[model samples]
Target: MVDRVAARAHETIDRVAAKAGPAVEKLRESASTYREQLHAKADRLGALEEQWIDSARSYVREHPFTSLAVAAVAGMVIAKIFSSSHHR
Candidate 1:
């Protein structure tokens, strides 16, 4: 009787595993697709960041004085914001 019970349990586990095989494979394929999509998006974002950096560099090179003035003004504004927030 004990042997019979053990055999039945093994059979049940085997059946469950067989039933789950296709579902597990489907999940793996879906995960691979999502991974591919995420990689593509990351690549595009990296390119966009490079483009923005290049454009900013060009702008600064063309207008060094203007860029310096803008940066100074921006710095003052940021400092004021931070100081006021701290006082509050």
Candidate 2:
């Protein structure tokens, strides 16, 4: 009886592992696909960011005075926000 019980337990474990193997493989494939997709998206976003930076640099070169005024206004706005938060 003891031998029979141990054999049954071993069979049960083997069956569970067999059933789970395919499911685990499917999950791995899904994760790999998602990883590829995320990498593609990251690459595209990096390209877009580079283009934007290049455009901004060109614009700044073309209009240095406008950029300086914009920067000064942005600085004042940021300072005001920080000062107000501190006061509160």
Candidate 3:
């Protein structure tokens, strides 16, 4: 009886280990896929940043005074909005 019970327990452990092995492998596969997706997104973001930098530099060179005036006005508006909201 003791030998039978031990064998049964070992069998149960083996069964659980077998199930867990596949689950772990699937999780690893999913992580690898997510890493690939993130790399693709990072590449796209890099291209977008380069595009924006080139556009911004060109705009600054073309309209330095206009850009500075617009920036100053926008900053003043934002500061006023925040300052008023915080006071309230």
Candidate 4:
């Protein structure tokens, strides 16, 4: 009787493991696919960022005075925000 019970327990464990194996494999494949997609998106975003930086450089060079005025206004706004936060 004990031997039969042990055999039955072993069979149950094996069945459970078999069922779990395919589920685990599917999960691994899904994770790998997601990782690849994220890498592709990051590469595209990096290229876009480089393009924008180059465009900005050209614009700044062509209109230095305008860029300076914009920078000054932005700096003042940032300073005002920080100063107000500090007072609070």
Model 1 stretches with alpha carbons more than 4 Å out: 1-4
Query: In model 2, which runs have C-alpha deviations exceeding 4 angstroms?
Result: none
TM values, all candidates:
0.85, 0.93, 0.84, 0.92
- Per-residue lDDT of candidate 2, residues 1-88 (tens digit): 9999999999999999999999999999999999999999999999999999999999999999999999999999999999999998
Q: Give the per-residue Cα lDDT of candidate 4 at 29.
A: 100
Off by over 4 Å in 3: none
Against the hidden true structure, what lDDT does model 1 obtain?
A: 0.99
Candidate that would win on TM-score: 2
Off by over 4 Å in 4: none
Indicate the TM-score of model 4.
0.92
Worst 10 residues of 4 by lDDT: 15-24
Error of 4 at 11 (Å): 0.7
Total clashing pairs for each candidate? 0, 0, 0, 0
Q: What is the C-alpha RMSD of each candidate to the true structure, in Å?
A: 1.5, 0.9, 1.6, 1.1
Candidate 1 per-residue lDDT over residues 1-88, each given as its tens digit: 9999999999999999998999999999999999999999999999999999999999999999999999999999999999999998
TM-score of 1: 0.85
lDDT of 3 by residue, 1-87 (tens): 999999999999999999999999999999999999999999999999999999999999999999999999999999999999999
lDDT of each: 0.99, 1.00, 0.99, 1.00
Ranking by TM-score: 2, 4, 1, 3
TM-score of 3: 0.84
